[model samples]
Target: MKKILVVGLFLIFACGSESKAQAPDAVKKTFQAKYPGENDPDWHQDDHGYFEAHFKIDGIKYRADFNADGSWVETETSIKKKDLPKAIKDVIKDKYGSEDISEIEKVDSASKGVFYDVEFKQKGKNKDVEFKADGTIIG
Candidate 1:
């Protein structure tokens, strides 16, 4: 009787570990299809227990949020080369006089007005500058 109980307990523990080790295959498949070209993206559980895909496309990174059951909720893409505003370009060139500003992005905030965010590396220290649509520094 003791041996039988031990075997049963072992089986239960093993099954639990297996379940924890495996994510829902259906969820992974759906996520891959939804976020077409994301390479080796990481899936993280959000507050609502949904999975989010953090991936890059066309050299621009993005975060695709999906529901717990594998349904897509929303996607946020970082500022891409083709999406930068002209006002931001002038400001970055002038402010960071000697630095090479690699990328500039115009981020549309839901609450605040549109802003220009610039990314540059100065003396090996990465810096991000946020400016208003009119080229005024906001951050």
Candidate 2:
């Protein structure tokens, strides 16, 4: 009886872990079709009820967010600060001269053009700023 109980418990734990590691079928299929990459991706459900795909293609890391129904939302990818448009970089540097930029991400959206979101720490507080393609601050 003890042997059987141990085996059952092991199986239950294994099954739970396996299922948690898999993304839902619809979300997985949509990501595979859109990404069209050779590598498998991981899926996560965000607090906003959106499915997000975290993967890499051609060696560049990316996270693509999708709705529950498999509709594409946006992709967030890290980018070098120098890769940003000169005007945008200049504005950021000039405005936040004291703060150091920790990270920059390129946000690609279906409905809007690409934008850069920069994360910085200022006076012990963390802040993020969004800039449009033309160097204008949107948020």
Candidate 3:
């Protein structure tokens, strides 16, 4: 009886972990078709009920989001401040001259199109600013 109980508990734990790590088949297929040759992405469900695949390509970290039905939503990659367009850089320098930039990411969204997300720390709080390639603030 003791042996059987131990084996049953081990199997339960193993199955639970496997299910948590595995994404739906549709989501995996879409990700593979979109990002061919990329494997072993860390998957998690986001707050918006979307599945996010976190992976790296050529040393740059990237995140790709997909809907439950396997539809692609967006992909984002971090970028350096210098990599931002000259217009955006100028605007940031003018408006946020006092704050230091903490992070920058280039986002390609299905609905909103492409934009840059810039983060700044002001008064011990984090502020995120979204800018278009032409330096227009959209969000």
Candidate 1: clashing pairs of residues: none
Q: How far out, in Å, is residue 60 in model 3?
A: 1.0
- Which is the leading candidate under TM-score? 3
Across residues 1-139, which tens digit of lDDT does each residue of candidate 2 receive? 9999999999887664223335567767777788776356776677676777788877899988788777888989999988999988889879987788889999998767688999997677779999998889988
Clashing pairs for model 2 are: none
Q: Report the error of model 1 at residue 120, Å.
A: 1.5
10 residues in a row with least lDDT, candidate 2: 15-24
Instruction: Residues 26-100, candidate 3: write the lDDT tens digits.
Output: 999999999999989999776677888999999999999989898999999999998999999999989888888
Please provide, for model 1 over 8-64, each residue's C-alpha lDDT reduced to its tens digit, 9 standing for 90 to 100. Answer: 999887663112222356667776787666547766666565566667777777665
What lDDT score is found at residue 138 in candidate 2? 80
TM-score for all models, in order of appearance? 0.44, 0.77, 0.80
Candidates 2 and 3 compared by TM-score, better number: 3
Backbone clash pairs for candidate 3 read none
Error of 1 at 131 (Å): 1.9
TM-score of 1: 0.44
Relative to the unseen true structure, what is the C-alpha lDDT of residue 39 in candidate 1, on a scale of 0 to 100? 45
